[model samples]
Target: MPDHLSPDPLHILHEVFGYDQFRGPQQAIIEHVTAGGDALVLMPTGGGKSLCYQIPAIARQRAGYGVSIVVSPLIALMHDQVGALHEAGVEAAFLNSTLSFDEAADVERRLARGQITMLYAAPERLTTPRFLSLLDGLLSRGQLALFAIDEAHCVSQWGHDFRPEYRGLTVLHERYPGVPRIALTATADALTRTDIVERLQLEEAGRFVSSFDRPNIRYAIVEKKDVTTQLLRFIEAEHAGDAGVVYCQSRKRVEELAATLAGAGINALPYHAGLDAKLRQQHQDRFLREEGIVMVATIAFGMGIDKPDVRFVAHVDMPKNIEGYYQETGRAGRDGEPADAWMAYGLQDVVNQARMIDESPAGDEFKQVMRGKLDALLALAEATDCRRVRLLGYFGEHAVPCGNCDNCLHPPELWDGTETARKLLSTIYWIKKQNGIGFGAGHIMDIVRGKKTDKVAQYRHDTLSTFGLCAESSEAQLRGVLRQLIATGALHVDAAAFNTLQLTDGSRAVLKGEVPVRLRASVSAPAARKPRAGRREAKAASPAAATLDAAGLGRFAALKAWRAEVAREHNLPAYVIFHDATLAAIAERAPQSLDDLQGVSGLGVKKLEAYGADVVRVCRGPHG
Candidate 1:
């Protein structure tokens, strides 16, 4: 029918997706799926992951007997994908609750006639008898191409956004064993990846694990003390008027931070589950469509969102796991420009996160796994070496000092943590043995510091054997030392029982002075997380010229005009395609040829090939 759906993926990739190349392991993945093989792809966000399966879907559909069924997690994502495919002149339709009865019936009729090449349905919809019956009908007619599962990380119980329905996706393979299946996610650790394989019954799937490194995003974690002031300062100093997200652990914090930003004359909005659905959607839409709009949100705000030009992602609270942190921070710099993954994390954030997990309806095993993940995130934050290396190492990738993160930009001075660890562990030990008690971090700290606080006196912890043992350190320094101990696996917290610090077997050697424990001194917290005074001064002194330069330095004013016009026309942010820095870089470099422009920083090879010629032509026009 459609020329037997060429087995060559590169041809199909160019013809259908209008792309001339494959990224990373996309070609290998496409071949695996097209050969009726199962695959799990772990590529980063904006890494051209969709092309892996989408091309194969078209190729299989052309072979005369199949329609590819895509199971997506988000309704909005389904709509956006289907709309994009339709615009590319491909036949695609999605079925979800958002569709009216008439629309549903029309899609159903189209399915029966095999008019649709690809169909997208949410997991909740797929399990319904109505939709399963429709799928059976299509398969019986030789109209089932393959199954493509998006956001496969949701299938893992350990993942941040695990969906129970995803556990049921195994039915697709059970019912249609011969059909190819592909499970794709941009974020999944080794454990989560294994869970995806097991839960989805993809034992035989060819796993494609790409490098989990996002080199363009600069990672930094500031020890969060006075988070509100820290957050305000960070947002104002580094990312003022740029598209960024300020994530809080609570909705109340989201509202408060949004109000703070607004009071500071910023266009900001609050987004959380507590808000009305319509209002949340409106705020999301505005954030997506309006440049310079800051979105203050809790963890629930971003999933399956396709905004490409977000420049920074600041975490006002620590995310629960490295997977969650990676996924959230991965949102920034999707355009391959320099972006900030700034976090203001403190010990309280850990307790609050643990409280949330402990209060959840999950099993003890689940809570333990979550706690382990949180511990891993803490290790990353406390690491004194290259932040990128430590982060990528968690995801099983090796990296060098990225020379972009704050730590890389300003390397911290590390000290021997061994003596400090010994003192801290010894303090925990002596306090436990003498008092027959395991206490919280604060009480233990007081005992170590020999402080006679009221609470310390109430517990008679002030006169413990370990009293004044760590008197050399201040209250804050002792807390930092303890945090590093916990991160290093020398200490554990028993959340199920009373929350108490328990020395692990790993701490035994340190307690016995059999081995040395070393730690890096924590950096001084950033000065109030505000915009750099120099940047502010630059803007203040050259406001007019800066404005004009942001408009492409007067070159291609018409392009700027067109960008603004089209941004309004499409209800999208003008910066979504390119940031002002990118534009300025292009204008200043003014590469007359595409080859020349490819050398400019921030212009990835694909982007250079895609828009380089046009940008150069615009640079040479009379608008300059």
Candidate 2:
């Protein structure tokens, strides 16, 4: 059969978490960690990755004089985590800017006395001399157990949330060679995984990678002519009152979109590192504690926020790479509920995203890799048959048709791409032969369609044998065909070396008519009639209707009314005190007992202890 089981740690998993069995690779991971072997865990969002480290920390702590040190990325996240650990009766403490000097000293005192089981700190704090000295002391006394790195992907320069301090964590090994290190991240690709290992010095660590599929999230990609209008319609219609995040490629766009949504009367907030720390904190707090408040942000927000009930995540601008898009969209529906992952992508979005990499100061290899990832994301966005299938395929996983996603629920008709791909590949080859220098799509299309443009004539490309071969097709059609060819690996873009177009081994089969190539027609094509403006707009809710209940099912009319009245008095956005979800949950689970109230999710100790009675009274009667 398999290796041994029935370890004492397995028993503790059932006893502490109320879970009888491990999901995916939990048993193997726990066994590895409990045995003091370092591990690098790569799992997707909502994949129970935290339990892999948390359970092992507890087990190893109980086994002997051990203390698990957790290095997190966010202060607010550390607070929530340490608080939860305290409620579970785990001796946990965090050192960050939030704590006073005396309080920090108290935690250090506890650590020296072997009174703390787990400690959380930011990477910046973890690398400090004082903290290292303390760790040195702990190591000497044989009280240090293991080092767990959360958000491990942040250590990679190619990752979306790269942090410079993370690269310095190699000292953890140099300082304490005996402490086991477990690095964990919810999303990472092969390239990112390698970077994580190299940067963290986890050369000898075991890797536990779980499946990257998020079946509960429904993915949809819509190509739009007027992106702002489509985004408004989507937010208004699909995720009106439910909590969601809107990602923008630019800080200016983030601000403008947030303002536009607010002008339209939606409770939308802008979040980016450019904003003041206080404002960012305020927006983050509202997003976590309140429900239905949309946060329009750049890549800075939503790293480790534990608010699990985000109903949807929308992308107003295309993300930098697939990993980024995956992590951003994965933030939605984390509570195992129905959630929508929607995006409005266009040709300009693709160009702008590529241009961003082109402008970066990174090496040529890094930029090329980044472009490859971007192209992959674009291909997935342009796929018609099954979005989920294409998404999981990138991470090397198979999936049945996920009925929740847009394409699986509404499969698109595929067109034969043999002639189209051959025509495009011929154009690229003909252009390269005719003019040694590469040209962008517009100029290349002009030459192919016999436009006789000034640039095309200047290069004498009109006389090429393959010129005007696709003159029957419109400019948009030819462009679409070229894009599809590039996306499907029949054509490749070499942006770093010379921005040249080259064909892969797969393109030869297509040229020989040996393989059937198909692609989804543009959703906004003339043949595919545009969705009625009135209907699209009608799908969206009015400003008044955007503030609904947790499920967006309209049970919080009175609660919203009360919030509006209170907000007007305080001149706030009805979410400063309590979120709609919190209120609706309070309304639904009108806990008569203190234990019941404390058990309510999102109702942390501060809220439960401060406003528990008031909330109970409100749920008990009309005036409460």
Q: Per-residue lDDT for 310-404 in model 2, tens only?
A: 77798877787788889988898665555778887765566566567877898999988987898889788777767888888877778877765
Write down the RMSD of all candidates, one decimal each: 5.5, 6.8
lDDT, candidates in the order shown: 0.76, 0.74
Q: Candidate 2, after superposition: displacement of residue 99 in Å?
A: 3.6
Which residue window of length 10 is worst by lDDT in model 2? 526-535
TM values, all candidates: 0.84, 0.77
Model 1 stretches astray by more than 4 angstroms: 1-12, 15-17, 354-364, 430-435, 496-498, 526-624
Instruction: Name every residue pair that clashes in candidate 2.
Output: 236-540, 237-540, 290-579, 618-624
Candidate 1, run of 10 with poorest lDDT: 536-545
Candidate 1's error at 445, in angstroms? Answer: 2.7
